[model samples]
Target chain A: MATRVQAAPFDLAAELAGFGQGPKVGAVVTFTGVVRDDSGTLRHMEIEHYPGMTERAIAAIEAEAAARWNLVDSLIVHRYGKLAPGEAIMMVATAAPHRGDAFAAAEYLMDYLKSRAPFWKKEFTAEGAEWVAAKSDDESALTRW
Target chain B: MIDVLYFAWVRERIGLPKERLATSAATVAELVAELRSREDRYAAAFADLDALRVALDQELSSFDAPLAGVREVAFFPPMTGG
Candidate 1:
């Protein structure tokens, strides 16, 4: 598995392909989250994370995914630093013997990540910059899985 | 002794990004209460405890968690990072 937290842009195609290997693994599912322009409603976003804790959180989430799913491999790439609208923010890919595990693990990983990760976003909006709040729905996603 | 960090609005509220603190408290909640007494900046930052998230040694943790064996502590807004 590959997990990266960097400032440079990532190649989803390369990442998905790199994670796909062996005839036993027939399905690979990936999710990419990007910063949307939102028609200028959001000027820019500042992503804040604790250097060491952010990684540890990601690793813990990945470990949880591995335990609950029949996954062959996984790649979680999350970028930090200032990001503009329409830029890729993060991606999660899972490979498994079947599409069921791959998709389930992919969603499970994202759901756990959204609710538990140690990162924050400050949005520069027309009203002013504000720290985004935790959404109940996002937190609720973890309950189903 | 522990290195504490604040991020985003939490940092803005505390008027600092980082600081080294010496404390006898055993849990994150105690440490926050101590800082809240230092000044209004800290009080405002920690006013809504539920909205904020805490990390011990760079891992997500609860407020009641002990500080024993901890080297770092961080507080920040809930995650919006995708």
Candidate 2:
């Protein structure tokens, strides 16, 4: 298991190269979040995170996923700082002995990461910049777990 | 002294990223009360406790959590990470 929090972009191909190759690992799942300009007025996004808390919070969520699923391996990579639209924001990968476990663990990790992590996003637009508000749907999604 | 950090709109509203404060407040709620009493910016930023979240020593914590031996405190809105 690994968790990386950095300002630099990550290579998706390189990260998945040797993901889960062991005999015990039969399935692998990955999810990537990208910066979207749905409104077309977005210029860039600024992702602010608590320097010391972000990593710790992600690690804790990763641990919970591991305990809940039969995960053979797991990885979470999140980026911070200013990013343009179309850039990748974060990614999560999970490997398990079966497809069910791998898929479920990946979704669980995403639900927790969305609300529990200590990172915030601000969108810069032609008009101005505004902090993104936490969605009630995201919070409600956690109740399923 | 406790290191107080703010993020996102909270930092923007308060016009600061971090500060070191010498406070006699015993819990997160008391510390917030002390800060809210200081200036209009703080009062505005901390006006709605329900809209804000607090962390003690970089860990998510409740407002009533004790401040004894805690070196850091942070206040911000609910996270919107993914």
Candidate 3:
């Protein structure tokens, strides 16, 4: 049960080294998001987050996922500040006794993080910078759970 | 005085990140109305309420929520996190 909001990059191998180590734990699921330069003009992506509220919101979402999925352990690491294409933006990992629980919990965490978190992204391109807008499809995805 | 924060395009339009103001508005909507009346920039930023979101004391809340004891209020565009 951990949530980290930082500007520094995280090491995935180091993060997963000790994941799901408990005796009953049988599955560990991980998802990593990276900055994509889909338009081929991006210089960097600036991520801004509400300083005091981002962590709390993520923690609350993680708690909900834990309770709903009976998770053995979970972790969420989200980065702020500027990032280049191919850089890791964030990651979520879940540990559970069964693969279904682990997978579902990881997916749930990602879905909630997409819209409920207080972070915003602004992409800097060769032309200029523009703020990213929330996608209606992302909000609709929440109806599944 | 209550602290008012803005983010994303809201901050860009408002030309600042945060401000401390003395407000007597009863709810988030009233505060918004007051701000909207103050200047053209605020009016432009808050022109479309449906395109914006509000947070009270750092927690996501509704526009109609009361501001009885809230020390902070944040306004921003819809979140685009992941």
Candidate 4:
């Protein structure tokens, strides 16, 4: 189990090294979120987070996901600060004995991280900057679990 | 004294990140009320309670929750993290 909140970019390859290698682990699922510029006018994206609460909240979510699934290992690494378009924002990796458990646990971690985490995103476009609003769909997604 | 923090637009509008305040407000709502009464900046930042979320002692909490032993209170908009 590992949770890292940093401003520096993380290498997906380095993060996955030796991951999900235990004898009982058969399935490993990974998800990565990238900074996208759909409008083609974005200058950058700035991410703000409550330092103390951010770590605590994410660790709690990870703990919950572990409790809900049979897992061998899990990792969550999120980035804060300015990120250019196409930059990797964050990633989650889950390893379990079966594909079903790995997939479900990864999804569960994402759904909770979307709304429960303390990070906030603001987009700087050609015209101005605006804070990204939380989506109602993201909140409702939690009801599925 | 309790540490009060504002984030995102709440921090921008209020023009600061955090402050230590001595208050007798019994709940989060009352603390908000007291801040709102301070000046235009606080009032404007807290004009709509629906747009804001609060945390007590770093844990997400409701505005009606008591402030008995909370050492930190944070106010911010809904999270957009993933």
- How well does chain A score by TM in each candidate? 0.93, 0.98, 0.98, 0.99
Q: Which stretches of candidate 1 lie over 4 Å from their true place?
A: none
User: Global lDDT of each model?
Assistant: 0.85, 0.96, 0.95, 0.97
DockQ of each: 0.75, 0.93, 0.91, 0.93
Query: What TM value does chain B of candidate 1 have?
Result: 0.97
RMSD of each: 1.5, 0.7, 0.6, 0.6
Q: For every model in order, what is the iRMS?
A: 1.4, 0.6, 0.6, 0.4
Off by over 4 Å in 4: none
Point out the higher-scoring one by TM-score: 1 or 2. Answer: 2
Instruction: For model 3, report DockQ.
Output: 0.91
lDDT leader: 4
Worst ten in a row by lDDT for model 4 chain B: B49-58
TM-score of chain B of each: 0.97, 0.98, 0.98, 0.99
Minimal lDDT window, size 10, model 4 chain A? A17-26
- lDDT of candidate 2 over A1-145, digit per residue (tens): 8999999999998999988879999999999999999999999999999998999999999999999999999999999999999999999999999999999999999999999999999999999989999999999999999
Each model's TM-score?
A: 0.94, 0.98, 0.99, 0.99
What digit string (tens of lDDT, one per residue) describes model 4 on residues A1-145?
A: 8899999999999999978987999999999999999999999999999999999999999999999999999999999999999999999999999999999999999999999999999999989999999999999999999
Instruction: Report iRMS (Å) of candidate 4.
Output: 0.4
* lDDT (Cα, 0-100) at A9 in candidate 4: 99
Tens-digit per-residue lDDT, A85-105, candidate 3: 999999999999999999999
lDDT of 4 by residue, B25-80 (tens): 99999999999999999999999999999999899999999999999999999999
